[model samples]
Target: MLREIYLSTALLAAFGLVGAGLVALVHMGTAERIEANREAATLARLHEILPDGEYDNDIINDTTVLSHALLGGGQHLVYRARRNDEPVAAVFTVIARGGYSGDIHLLVGVRENGQVAGVRVISHRETPGLGDDIEASRSDWILGFDNLALDDPPMERWAVQRDGGIFDQFTGATITPRAVVRAVRDTLIYFDTHREQVFTPIPVDPTDEEAHADE
Candidate 1:
């Protein structure tokens, strides 16, 4: 009976190892294709928010990820679009955590001049009817942010009407809209202050160049 038990255990271990190897092989084979699909979808969203003919550079190739307060204190991707090697616009994703139900993810486009080109809610877990209006398809409230700037609405006036600002809150959801408004404001401010840094090209390392040459 003991020998039979050992044999069963060995068989189970071998099967587990084989399953893991197959999973790894599948992952390795599909990784690049999956990444390509993801990148394409991201670029589609980026172009949707940016104004037509605003940029000609390969925004996907000129991307950077940073962990900062404006981006919900987590890693966020920032895409830079340029025309003739000159900066034209920036698209980035940010999160608003004060939603009615949970955090809201937003994609924001800002022109080189600091004005917002457009904003879109990538995903959110806010109340179904109230917070869902933040989406462009459901309501036009998000359109109000187009062409907005820091001083146009004024930093102090970046709240909903109940708080004496210009934006309108949903019929039953004040917290959601207010949180979104503040998030856009913060994202704009972050880009405005970091404009030079954002547009700066990353310097190639000399050591890496030598290593590549050796290879």
Candidate 2:
């Protein structure tokens, strides 16, 4: 009876190992394809904010992760665009933390000359009709950021009109648009302060290279 019990335990252990190996194999087999699909989706969105013809490089892969208070205090991805090897623009995925409901995610594109190329709301929890107008589909308000600069409206006047600024706020949902304006301005400031680092290539980890080689 003890021998039977021991054999049963061994068999169960073997099965567990086999199951884990199969999962790992499946993940390894599909990992590259999964990554490719994610990259494709991100590239499509990036093109929406910054035209594909504006830059010649592979903007999707030309990215770096950064964190700063001006960028909502957590790691955010930054994509760089170049024309003839010269910096053209940088797109930042910024988070607006003062939204009426919660955080609002934004993709802000700023050119090398400091003008805003474009801005898009990736996600938001603002009110349906009022705050939701910040979206391009809901309204063209987000497009007003194009060609704007910190000095264009003056740093002090970057808030919504209700706050004595240039941009207009939603009639019933002031917090949502206000948060987005602040976040975009903050992203521009971040880009201005970190231009060199923003365009610099991310260093490759030796371990990562070795792992790829092994694969």
Candidate 3:
């Protein structure tokens, strides 16, 4: 009886090790493919926010990470676009954490002129019928953000109508829209103040970036 138990335990451990090894092998084999697929998906989303012809550089590879309180206090990726060796716009992935259900991720493209190139919701867990209206497929409400800037909306009016802003709030949902508006507003502000930093070339280093002053 005791011998039987030991045998079963030994078999289980051996199987577990084999399973782990298999998983490791599969991960190693598919790692690059998985990463490529992810990059393709991200590029698709980026194109939605800032379509082709908007810039003449590889936006995907021209990126830098930004960590700012205005951007939800988390590390976020900023993709820069340039044309003829001059920066055109900066695309940011910002988070709206006051959504009705949970955090809402947004990809916002702000032109060098301070105008918004476009905005797209990357992900969210808001109510399907109400808060979800922020999505392009669900409704064109988000389209209202195109060409917008801090001055366009007037900084003071960067909130849902219910909150005395020019933006319209959903019939039954205000929290979601309000959250999105605030996040977009903050993102624009950050980009405006840190335009050079936001559009820093790929693999930005703090001391190296400050060298812009000499150049």
Please, what is the TM-score per model?
0.81, 0.81, 0.81
Which runs in model 3 stand beyond 4 Å of their true positions? 1-26, 203-215
The reply for model 2, stretches above 4 Å from the true place, is 1-30, 204-215
lDDT tens readout by residue for model 2, 1-215: 99999999999999999999999999987998899899898998898888899999989888889999999998998999998989999999999999999999999999998899999999988889889999999999999999999888999999999988999888999999899999999988988898888988668899999999999
lDDT of 2: 0.92
| lDDT (tens digit, per residue) of candidate 1 on 1-215 | 99999999999999999999999999987998899999889878887798547787888888888677987878998889899989998888899878898899999888899999899999998877778999999999999999999898888898899999999988889999998998999988898888887788767899999999999
1 or 3: which has the higher lDDT? Answer: 3
Clashes of each: 0, 0, 0
Q: What is residue 115's positional error in candidate 2, in angstroms?
A: 0.8
Q: Which stretches of candidate 1 lie over 4 Å from their true place?
A: 1-29, 205-215
Model 3 lDDT tens row, 49-115? 7886879998888888999989988899889989986998888999988999999999988999999
C-alpha lDDT values of all predictions = 0.88, 0.92, 0.90
- RMSD to the hidden true structure, all candidates: 3.9, 3.8, 6.2
